[model samples]
Target: MGTASSQLDPEVTEKVSRDVNDLISKHRVVIFAKNICPYCHMAKNVFIEMNEAYHWVDLSKRPDGREMQYFLADLTGQSTVPRVFVNGKCIGGGQETQELYKKGILQNLLNQS
Candidate 1:
């Protein structure tokens, strides 16, 4: 399978592809989310508590949200929202983010190479 992009109009898919790439490249943290997703909210809370700002892509509000989520599934190996990334790497979702927080690894990951 190529990616979720294949499901979209090729033009939109291409643009979202570029947007996703730009986001992961330029942001320290990124979350692919829907507006009402609790997990996505929880994930954002973790970063906020850290006093970190992240790129929050509210897919529900975007025309390309679904396609982007599909692309993210390919990138992170997960289809769920609240897909979190740090330092240009997929760290995971709500529970995973919390686990890392509880272990004190989240801080380390924030700044590590």
Candidate 2:
């Protein structure tokens, strides 16, 4: 069965896709998140502790938030907040990000760029 995002208008979906891609391309690290989500906070804290700067979109605060989340689900195969990208690649979400941080892999990913 098709997902809800698949039911979205093609034009809107395309625009959101392009806009998101542009954001990802423009930042070395990007977190697509919702403000109240603790998982999102955890992910953000990882970068903060590393003293690395990142760009993050608070999906809950945007008019297009729901569409963005749907787009993320389509792109990453998961529908969760704190969808993180390093160097324009999906590195999974909060707990996954925390795992990478624990293993010291996240830092390495950051340093590569």
Candidate 3:
């Protein structure tokens, strides 16, 4: 089955894009996730284990969640949840986060301010 249409209205896409950009710029770590996603929990747990602070948007609880997901896919080339960004760059999702952590590179990225 094909993915759902990602063509949101220009104004809406612009607004969502701006909002997402603002979040990335304002926070050292940002995770775009769905509340019930296990991968989301796994990704967030890494930060918790390291005692690091992060900002997360639970898209499942937001009115524009689907749009945001679509926007994230467009930005990161992944339509999955737990899209984690650190140092204003897409580090990828849960599995990728775990991999980075194991490689010790995730710490280096977090150290950048």
Q: Pick the candidate with the highest TM-score.
A: 2
The better-scoring model by TM-score among 2 and 3 is 2
Better of 1 and 3 by TM-score: 3
lDDT of 1 by residue, 10-87 (tens): 887778779998999899899888989999999999988989888999999987788888888877788998889898
Ranking of all predicted structures according to TM-score, beginning with the best and ending with the worst: 2, 3, 1
TM-score of each: 0.89, 0.96, 0.93
| Best candidate, lDDT | 2
lDDT of 2: 0.92
**Lowest-sum lDDT 10-residue window in model 2:** 1-10
lDDT of 3 by residue, 1-113 (tens): 42332467878888888989999999999999998999999899999988989998999998888888988888888999999999899999999998999899999999887
Compose the digit string of candidate 2's lDDT tens values, residues 1-113. 78767888988888889989999999999999999999999999999998889998999898888998999999999998989999989999999999999999998898887
The order by descending lDDT is 2, 3, 1
Candidate 2: stretches off by over 4 Å:
none
TM-score of 1: 0.89
> Over all chains combined, what TM-score does candidate 3 have?
0.93
Alpha-carbon local distance difference test for all models? 0.87, 0.92, 0.90
Worst 10 residues of 3 by lDDT: 1-10
